[model samples]
Target chain A: MNMIEAAAVHVRFGDRVVLESVDLAVAEGEFHGVMGPNGAGKTTFFNVLTGRVKPNRGRVLLAGEDVTGLSPHRIAAKGIARSFQIMTLFDEFSALDNVMMGLPEFRARSHDVARAAAGDSRFAAKSSEALAAVGLADKGDIRAKDLSYGDRRALEIAVALAQAPRVLCLDEPTSGLGSDGVQRLAALIARLKGRLTIVAIEHDMEFLFSLADRISVIHWGQVVARGTPHELQQNEWVRRSNLGKFA
Target chain B: MAAPLLVLDDVRKVYTRGRVIRRPTFTLQANLSLDEPDIVGVVGPNGAGKTTLFEMMTGSNAPTSGRVLVAGTDIHGVKYRERDRLAIHYHQSYQVRRFRKRIPSAFLAPSPTRTPLVHLFDEPQFNLQDGYIGFMLDFFRKLRDEGRLVVLCMHPTAAWHLDILAEIAGRFLFVAGGGVTAVANFGALVADPRCRSYLGPEMTKAADAICHGAVHSST
Candidate 1:
């Protein structure tokens, strides 16, 4: 069964439709990549998954359970963790603290635990491990406000990883990174393969090509093509669309 | 020729917590000449003292030794109120609680005496949801066109915003361990041979520094 399934979903704002009859499914432990131009409804799709937007029509299923109108927090509780295109780190908080905030249902699950225990040596170890996984292990204590841009992006990924979710969604993970930085992120994603299901929206074709197991092209709020990276690379229609430039 | 935009001479800082003395006297002497717009990238390892250098440069923390001059004027010599009036520091983890709120008009407020140089410690890592990233990119561009110098201190992960940084600032500075190892125009910096070599090392350091503060114990 698919981990996440969106069937014939439609989303509109006033007279404009952002997503029209879009159908997509994420298999267990699959690394899915969504590629498109601006206004192609990539972010709108994320909104639908997180229940930030109620689809005008159609249904969303998580692990075979219908969740079309569930709240974002509820969806998150159900093992979905998303990192924004632009980072949402807590500036005043330390990097470790930011990752702690991303822990799944920690508030309720660890309520009985004392504050000192919450900030215990073990928790710190886990946070450090997450930081190191994203190549930010050394920056655990620096305030979010003090990091450089590339490091901040890595921290965002670290926060998502901290959730230990079954599904991970990343928006434009390589949007502003230089070539080397993009390569590092791709390497990190590659390492996480098979352990988690990933759905990423990205514009950088090079990085996506290297990291994505499957590619879905979105345009005019619809799924124009879906295939393995090589298949999508050869599709005639994809060749004619925005994917051509990247090709 | 047009007066150094920012100058630092033998700047030193010491962190002493009781008996534990960490780098009691770290020094950096640099002459930064910014006659036009520039984007400087400060790169360093965690505990390499990147933030400490920024603090001393921006006057957020006083240096144990040496002088910092901005626009041919000694920043340390100026009164705190006057310095505050002349500088704007945007730290990382800068949050935008409201998406609808307009960009602070104070950012665009006129400065008749000298061109305002904005310091963004980690502006890109802040809340960038709801088109705010585009808004900030455009805003910084305008500041650059007006001849303002914008300095951004970024960790390796936040390095993706360099495109926006390049569009806004013409020059760049890469600081590591309370010192600048590389300085150039945004274009030149990207193409610089030294930038690639030093970027990874400096980023690792910055990340280490952040981790040190967050975990508060050995990894």
Candidate 2:
């Protein structure tokens, strides 16, 4: 069964249709790649699938369960988590605190200064473990503001991973990182490949081509092409679109 | 593989602020290891500790914790003048040149010279004519050809040598607010989505173009 699927999903903002009856599906444990030009409804598609947007028509499903029109929080309860294109870390909090907030169980309680400050606590241990998984274990005590851009992104991913989602959707996951930052993030994502079902919207042709096991090109809010990287690389239509230059 | 020319192991620097209530600050923390002839390109947003890492590598600033070795020599324990035997620091004038970071007036206009195993170019492109940048790039490349490690520290906003570095450098060290992460080599670096994400779209696009052209030349 597909991990996540959007069947003929349609979304419109006022008179303009952002996603025009789009369809996308991520297989179980597959590194499904989504690529397209700017304003092509890539993020809007993600929003519809994650429950941030209620599609004008069609249904969304996760692991064979219908999730269409569910509020974001409700869908999240159904095990879907996503990272934003912008840096979503709390600048004032330490790396540990940021990941701790990602924990689904911990986010319910009131903010606790004492627990956040205590390094040896269970919450801190869980937070630190998540950070360690992303190669930021040593940066747990450092304020997120002090972290490098790469480390901040790593912390962001740590936050997402801590949620223990069955389906993780990444929107332009590697958008703001430098060469070094990109490699580190790719390494982390590569490690997460077989363990988690990820749908990444990436514009970096080189990174996306190598990272995604199956490629899907979205344009004008539609799934224009879907296949292996080799097939997409040779698609005449993809070669004529904005992706043509990069492919 | 060639013997590692630069090794920074769990390096950390702490600073004290607030005269009324001063506490140690963790200003820099980096763990990087690179081999000889590696043109290590370091770039990040302002306050990312790119310069300080150069300083630490050059023995100008002592790390609060961890070790910095050049050609297998621990630089912090060495004498001041003797320090240059392995590294030279070309300081940059940041927008806010904190009192301590003030590059002595005499050293402000100093030119880069090849005298050490590692050359630290801290904002070398600052206050220079366009022509000098090309010269500096060639200078950096020449030293790399001679098996020296050239660590170029660039400001995020400044017009960096994005194409040149992408075409030549083998490794990249990204420092954000003092913490550092290593990207193994140029090929692996370019294929990272974060390259476009963290470095911004324009620069990453330019680097991708440059890397594409370089593949032909390198082959």
- lDDT (10s digit) by residue, model 2, range B51-120: 6777788776777789998877787766544465577665532432322333333433221222468876
Candidate 1 DockQ category?
Answer: incorrect
Per-residue alpha-carbon lDDT of candidate 1 for residues B1-219, written as tens digits (9 for 90 to 100): 665656666666655555655644455545455555555555445556666666556555666677776666665555442343344444432331111213333443332232235444443442222222333444455556666566666544443344344444455566554556555555455444555555565543433444244222211
Instruction: Give the residue spans of candidate 1 off by over 4 A.
Output: A109-118, A236-247, B1-219
Model 2 regions more than 4 Å off: A113-120, A236-247, B1-219
lDDT tens per residue, model 1, A1-247 = 7998899888877434567558889999899999765767999999999889999888988888998989998888887888899789988888887887677655555754347335567667777889999998788889898988888899998988987778889999987888888888888999999789999999887677767888777755667567787776564333433444555
TM of chain B, each: 0.63, 0.73
lDDT tens digits, residue span A167-189, model 2: 98888878888998889888998
Candidate of highest lDDT: 2
lDDT of each: 0.66, 0.73
Candidate 1 TM-score, true structure as reference: 0.51
Q: Summing lDDT over every window of 10 consecutive residues in candidate 1 chain A, give the lowest-scoring window.
A: A235-244
